[model samples]
Structures are given as structure tokens and as C-alpha cells.
Target: MSDKEQKSAYGLGRAARLNLSLEMLNEMANTGRPMDAVLSSYFRHLQDALERRDRRDLENRVRSVLLHYRRLLWWLKKIKLEPTMRAMLLADMILSENADIPQLEKLCNGARNRMDMLRKEEIAALKRLLGKEINHPDMSDAVQSECPDWAQAGLKKAFGETFTEELAALATKSTSDYRVNTLHTTPEEAQQSLASQGFKTEPCPMSPIGLRQSDAGGPILSETDAFRQGWIEVQDEGSQLVALFAGAKKGMQVVDFCAGAGGKTLAIAAQMQNSGHLVACDVHSKRLSRAKVRLKRAGIVNTQRVLLENTYDKWVKKSRGKFDRVLIDAPCSGTGTWRRNPDSKWSKDETDLSELVALQADIIKSANRLVKSGGRMIYATCSLLPEENEEQIENFLKENDKFTLVKAKTVWEENFETPYPCANEDYLRLSPHTNGCDGFFACVLEKK
Candidate 1:
């Protein structure tokens, strides 16, 4: 092909990016890679291979494709066609209005038969799939809700049927929200700094230091001076609440067990005014390494980073009954984070749930031992399912009579300046529909 034709055929647009992201989704499904890791790895490789800056719109378009993955698969099932044609016609259907059909020719490196099938499969199947409604009701509960059947049942049983509609929006459509690190600057100062740089931002209603910006049109958030200078960190409001309810005080010894990436650990440190000892422990060394960067960026110093060699580490054993408070951010199905990780909706299953629940039980029991008598421990997860949230805490209280439940409502009334979308009266539960944040569950337990 001529040089001009080559550029025209191979240029990656919205549809092409969606096709590429579908590859990421496939890897996440097949390889069990976290959606965040898979997407970041693919985009990084794409940018390196093409020797071009990433188009901001590309990630958004790809996310939209993944968000509608259930509907896309439903159509593929209906078409009676091979599932192997995902990158060509299947991705285009989701991006139909803006799909670049001609680009598929070069995406395939000038393969003729595949292109013909993509167009000619136009036979009867395309017609059937084309007219499907925006919220197609032809699907069962699982597909319509874009979740696993067990998750759908659990959420519905706990929250009600109307809650299922909110499940439809697996991810937030607005620009990401951030929490201002008061340890560095005030919320207004952080807002002003970002606004001065042409980033449109608004205060999050619930969090005193929460700032939100629309990704529709804005520079990359991580690139902002506010982030680099430790004025802000990308955190959800629900998360801020979880940390707030942890009730860390100055001069107190605290342990943030299972502190992945240190989002809440930083919050706890800031709340403690960097006064006392705070140990951030996690089993994953890589995640703690990432947390080390965030800690430095946030100008945090009070916290000690501990890499737990295992669930029962020597460090944990020495630290047991030493801390005034402990926070267990246990692993779960991650259904609550669907607003940020839409692909997770498709990846998790019952087997994963069984394993995670068992892990959570073990970690919570082990972590609770670190809390001193009369001290508090926040048992938390991003799972919407009660099995991982209330049930775990309930069982813990049942098994260990020395520890008692602390009402989330009572604590919220004491600390929060704004009202929360309260899901459970006892535990702090936030959902996407009611709270406009990622789904989260938190219950504070006190050691007697």
C-alpha cells in the first residue's frame, strides 16, 4: 500500500482503541489480571509501540466498551457467529456510530475473508442485534444487571430491587474525584491550584477536602502540580469516610493492616497529624512499593511500612496487642468498586468468593489481635455482598466475645460535617446510586 493509504488504514481511532481494550479485557478474563493492571499495561505498551502520546479520549472510549461488555456478549450470542470476531465486528457494534470500518482492513493487515465476513455476516444476525434497546430487557437478571447471578441476588436481597438499577451503572461516568491532603494544603488552596491550571473542579459534598473534576475534558490528574506537591490524592469520598471512621488520634499507635497502596493509611496519618506510630502492613511488596511513592508524594512520615511476609508474620506477632487502633482492608469480590473497575463485574465467580471470604476471615482474626484492649478496629471491604461485610464482622464478634461492634451511625454523627448515604445503620455502607461513590462497607469493632 502507498504511504498515505498505510497511515489511513492503520490509524487507531475510538473503535480501534475499543478493540485493543477488548484484548485487555480478554487478558483480564483469561489470565485473572486485575483490570487496572491489564488496562495500564496495554495502554503503556500501545503508547511505546506507536511512539505517540496517549489520546485522553482513548481510555474513556475503551472503558465504555468494557462497561457494555455484557450487552456486547449477548449480541454475539444472538448472532450465531463465532466469538472469535470480537475485534472486528463485535467491538464496532458497541462503537457503531463512530466505528471506522475501513480501519479493520489494516487492523487485520489486509485480510480479505475476515473483512467480508464482518460485512456479509450482515445476513440475518446483524439485523436482530442492531435494534436492541439501550436497557435491553430481553436478558435475564444477571445480564441485565451486568453482574454475576449470586452478586445480583445478594445486592438485591440486602439493598432491594431498585438497587439493581444502580448496578446498571457499573462505573462512574463523571471525571474522577480526589481528596485534598490537608497535611500539605487546604481544600480551597488545592482547588485553586488545579483551577489555575485550567482543570475544572468542584467540592465533593460529603468530604470536607474532596475535589472532583470531569474527565470529559481535562489534563491528566496525575500530571497536576497539586498531586506532585502532595496537595491532593486520587481517592473516593466513601474511602475518606472509611478512614475518618477509623478514628485515629494524635499520639496513638495504629496499624493499617492490608493497607493496599496506602490510600487510607495516608488519610489516617494526616488525621493523626503525623504524631504517633502508624504501621502500614501488606502482604504484597509491590503494592507497598507503590504506596511508598504515594506516601512520599503526600509528605507522610509518621507511618512505618511493613511488608508482611505472610498473613502471620513475625512483625505482626511482635506488634500484637500493641496498637490503639487497627484497620483491616480485607480482600473481597470487589463488587463495590465496579464504578471504577467495570471489567471486574465479568471476572469474579463463586469460587473466587469462597477463597476471598476465607482469606478475609483469617486476616481479620489475625489483625484484630494487634488492637489493644478498649482500642478500635475497622473491618472494611469494597465488597457490596454482606457475606464479606456484615457477616464477617458478625461472625468475628460471635467468635471473639472480647470484641464488640461499634455503630457506624453513631460515629458518623460525631465526625462528619455532611450527611452520608447510609446503607446499613451499624456499618458505614456506601453505594454508587445513592452515594454517587464506589460501593463500600465498614464496621468498627472495639476490643474490650
Candidate 2:
């Protein structure tokens, strides 16, 4: 067939093609079905249709489609619709089950009404815009090949007009960022060291130790001598800032409670100059094992890992009021890392948040008893939600009279750069969009 004839046979515009791909991805995510089969089926239909597109554009298009699916899933989760309902809708659409159309329409209407009732005005407005586009007869027929009537309706209900643009942006590649391992080398020295391995580094805008990769196609961890020598650690710049706020020093005893995989624990050890006794404690044995391997690779000799399976044990009693510093890097919903781990945005829910808050409160209360008189304890989370960050700390302080807020500005200035405007209350907040780093919240308190 001629090129013009092939293009006509496909009957797909860029927007329509993107919509079809997203519809397929939405089906995969909702049903927990394998994506390869769906993608295969799509390509099979397009076998002679997609003429000689560049490999890069093809990859970018696929990534964009997947990101759009993720964004739609995130919206659905935020509004508290049942995951199964979403899955069923996707299945009905992909399988072309016309009988399921009424059910899909009913769900979409119900979701819209719920949004209106809940005062989600922005989403409601978006819905109205999407409704017009999806309901157009010509577009409706084009979309029907991939999306069931209900699936098309759900897309309008889920994303509105901003959906396509948002997903495309999310699909774009993010840079590989690393925080300098301050214990072994300075940022300048680390940069020089990494250069020997043909890995170029540039300073991150917000973090003193953070470096962004300039080149691609290198196995950074294995190829770099600095990485093997522990001169650099793979950590978000925002996380490094949280560890600096902890203010741990040589010759002081410190505890990192809930130190999962030891990202911040390694930072604390570096700040302590590998001299102070730093105990890395967690409930998970596997995470502790990973931390141990990392600590050894980093040549940190003063740190110890402990598994606190029983918070009420006598070992806990002996540790009470003994440490100079404590860091509760509490478990959280991880909403701030969407740029890096987009999958987490779909996996979490309101019930998960509630459960995490309860666990955080319990852990904090247990750790609080171990802080010595006049010693500092910092509570930190990679969460943007106020309920997990400020509210959790406020509630903890309210219930525990012995501790009071220390000036976060004073501590941060003493250890690191002041990133935000000075506030009366002693707390630090960093958002990915605002701070050019992962979202984080940290508040330091001293026991009276």
C-alpha cells in the first residue's frame, strides 16, 4: 500500500493514538494484568500502520502513555473509589463488553457526584471539560476501538482536560541525582574522584553535597571508583538536609530509630565523623542486614544495627534517657517521591495513611523515653501531608511535656544552609516542586 493509504487506513491522530495507549494501560493497572500482552495486542493492530518512527519517539510515546495511566490511577485513588471498580471498568472496555456500559456510566456519575459533594471544585471543572471532548461523536467512534463506553466515560470522570499534558510531563526522564558521602570526602574531592571514572557531576541547586549526572549510559554504581570506595551515596538532596538537621556530632551517642536501609543512618555516621556510637534500630531484620552491608562499604566503624522486635523489653528500659540525639525517620505515605517512584502514588490509600500515623505515634512515644535530659531528637518524614508531618509532631509535643521545640533555623544554619524563610516556630519543610528536591519535613526538639 502507498504511504498515504497506510496513514489513512490507521485512522489515528496523535491525540487519538495517545488516548488508545492510555486506555490500554488503564486496563492493565486496574486489573493487575500483565502489560506486555496488552501492548502486544496494540502493536499487532498497528503492524503496518506506524511507519518508520524514530526509536526514541516510540519509547517516549510508550512512557507518556504509562505515565498518563498512572496519573489517572492516582486521581481515582485520591477520590476513594474501589480499585476493583476501576479494574472492572478497564476490563469491560478492553474486552468490549457492551453489556457493562450502563454500569460504567453509573460509576462515573457517582464519582462525579461524590467529587461535587466533597467540594473538589478543580476536579469538577476538569470533568466538565473532558465530558465535552469525549462525548463528541467523531472522537467517540475513534476511541471506541480501544475504550469501552464505560472506559471512555471513566477517563472523563478521572482526568478532565489536564490529564494528557500532565501525563506527558510525568513520562519525561528525570536526572540521576546523588548526595556526596560527607564522611569520606568533600563535594569538591568527590567530584574530582568521580571524574576519574568518566562520570561527570554537577552540583544540585539546593543541596550543598548533591550532584546531578550530566551524561548517560554508564553503570554509575559499578563503573565509578568513588561509589565502590564510598565517597558518594545515592540519596535525595532533601534527605541529606534532614540528616544534617539532626545535628549529630563526634563523641555523642545517637540513635536512628526506624532506620530503614540506613540512607540517613549513613549520613549521620558521616556527620559524627565515624567516632560517636550510632545505633541504627529497626523492626525489620532484612533492612538492618542491608544497612550493615552499606555501613561496611562506607567504612563506618562506630555504627551498630539493632533489631527492636519488642519495644517493651528490658533492653528498651536500659536505653531510656541515655542518648544525646535521637532521629525518628518515621514511616509515611511517601507522597513526595512521585517523581522518582510513580508507582507508590497508586499503591497508597487513606487507610494506609491512618495505619502509618498510628504506627508513627507508637514508635515516637517509645523513642521519646530514650532521649536524655537536654538532648535533642528530630522527627522527620518524606511526606507532604500535614497530618503525618506537623500534626504528628504537634500531637507528640502536646502529650509529652518534657520536650520543647528547638529553633530549627539555629540548628540548620549551624550545620547547613537555611533553605526557607525564617519562621517563629522551629520546623523545616521542603517540597519537590518548591525546593528542587524530594518533599521532607523535620522538627527538632530538646528534652527539658
Structural similarity to truth (TM-score) of each candidate: 0.89, 0.66
lDDT of 1 by residue, 1-448 (tens): 2334324322644444444545555666678787678767655555433322343444555566667666666766766755543532354453344424344434444232123234556434445544345355587766766676657777877677676676765545633788888888899999999988877788987888788885345566777898789888888887887888888999999999999899999999999998899999999999999999999878888989999888988887887789998989888888888877786776778788889999999998788889899998888888889889888888888889998887888878777867645856788887777778887888888889
Off by over 4 Å in 2: 1-66, 70-175, 217-219, 310-313, 418-425
Clashes of each: 2, 0
lDDT of each residue in 284-313, candidate 2, tens digit only: 899999999999999989998988875554
Write down the TM-score for model 1: 0.89
Give the runs in model 1 whose Cα sits over 4 Å from its true position. 1-19, 48-54, 85-119, 122-124, 171-175
Q: Rate the local accuracy (lDDT) of all candidates.
A: 0.74, 0.65
In model 2, where is the ten-residue run with the lowest total lDDT? Answer: 110-119
